[model samples]
Target: MKIRVSDLISRKERSKKIDYKFEIPKFEFEGDVITPVSKCEVSGVITSDKDIVIMKAKVTCTLEMNCSRCLDTFIYPIDIDIEERFANNNSLENEDVIIVLDDILDIAQVVESNIISSLPIQRLCKSDCKGLCQECGANLNKESCSCNNDDVDIRFDVLKGFFDNKEV
Candidate 1:
């Protein structure tokens, strides 16, 4: 996962080829609202092409999260494809290359960056999901509760009484 900068190739030096592989434990992140399960698998190959290095990575994992609306726990799937390049020697980017590393580049850092960066700003189970009812504390998705629906808003009772008092 770690590479030696001196071992890499540069226009001035002659280290033309490099390859490596390794595995690390799953990562965990804790937030105030939710704690994501750390079950991830990452693998990839690094190929050095002269002054440029090509890194192809595939990550697959699952996270246990609570549904934003109902607060029910559910399994969430994760999959991502990422490609990164490191450049050797400080040269202008006009030469069809990018990201030249100083001496060594950390693959774990790259993978971590991709995972955290790609996450949705706001995680939600669905677009049109109706959350749990504040009154009676019932999940709106499952079944209707016996609790008075009008209890959702007390202000509506004033209107309800006015209409009831009207003689038809």
Candidate 2:
């Protein structure tokens, strides 16, 4: 995706309707692999106001990701709303607006960036997902393991024997 904004810049078209579907490869983010399972669909409008071009679009896609706790593969649906500003002329300030190069708006990078930003920091399959057990490497959500999890410090052994003799 690249869209030509010359029509808007030339004042021939006030707005441009964009409807496109594209594919993206797997992305490595935060030590996790995000694989796109569906085509990314972007639908929105680009409007020109004076020398500034504004693009508002909704991006949608399904991604295959792993659960952070248990490392199980799962599908993660993503929907991102993007609003970007571009400057067609040199008179506008360059800090906030992306400068249009050769009258084209390359939206691939923008869409990809939005998708990456929208991902959750911690991906979970469920709210109460029981992760894997540390002792027997068992999936806690599936089965229980007889692993002794009560850890006591060696420095408290003298106190433990003293407390065991007291009835209170």
Candidate 3:
């Protein structure tokens, strides 16, 4: 959501608190589109200290994603704390700080960044997912397969013969 901070920038008040709710549509990342299962809410206070504006917010949302192991779809809840600093002056050399432009603060970019960064590296449907069987492409978590475990590929039989001829 784009918030116009012109009032906050011009006002004499040093600090202000604002609450916001937004519906973030599905966003694509790494060729995968993730959609939110519920509305996202953010509440925070903006404090001005000299020429710097500090914004602290808490964001909450539920998103739908596919499991990395089993490729199953599931819901994931996110609750993260966001802290950002905006500088009213341009002479600051810190690259981490955001520069306010036209007295506007577009919080949608911030929210998206936080949500993406907070996501787990590997998404799993369950804690102990057995994954798909390599032999017959069966789901190991569902049932047992008929493929034999002791069977070896015929291409490697020459190596097996060397082991059988060993004295040991």
Tens digits of per-residue lDDT, candidate 3, 9-36, equal 6678877775888888898766667889
Cα lDDT of model 1 by residue, 1-168, tens digit: 577644655345533332333343444444524344654566666666776777777876666656777877666677898787777666735666555456678766777677766766656566666778877778887766776555436766567677668887
Q: Which ranges of candidate 2 are over 4 A from the true structure?
A: 89-91, 151-168
What are the root-mean-square deviations of the candidates from the true structure over C-alphas? 5.3, 2.6, 3.0
Candidate with better lDDT, 1 vs 3: 3
Best by lDDT: 2
Choose 2 or 3, whichever is better by lDDT.
Answer: 2
Q: In candidate 3, what residue range of length 10 has the lowest lDDT sum? A: 1-10
> What's the CA error at residue 12 for candidate 3, in Å?
2.4
| lDDT on C-alpha atoms for all candidate structures | 0.63, 0.85, 0.79
Order of candidate numbers by TM-score, starting with the best:
2, 3, 1
- How far in Å is the alpha carbon of 19 misplaced in model 2? 0.9
In model 2, the Cα lDDT at residue 150 comes to: 57
For TM-score, the strongest prediction is: 2
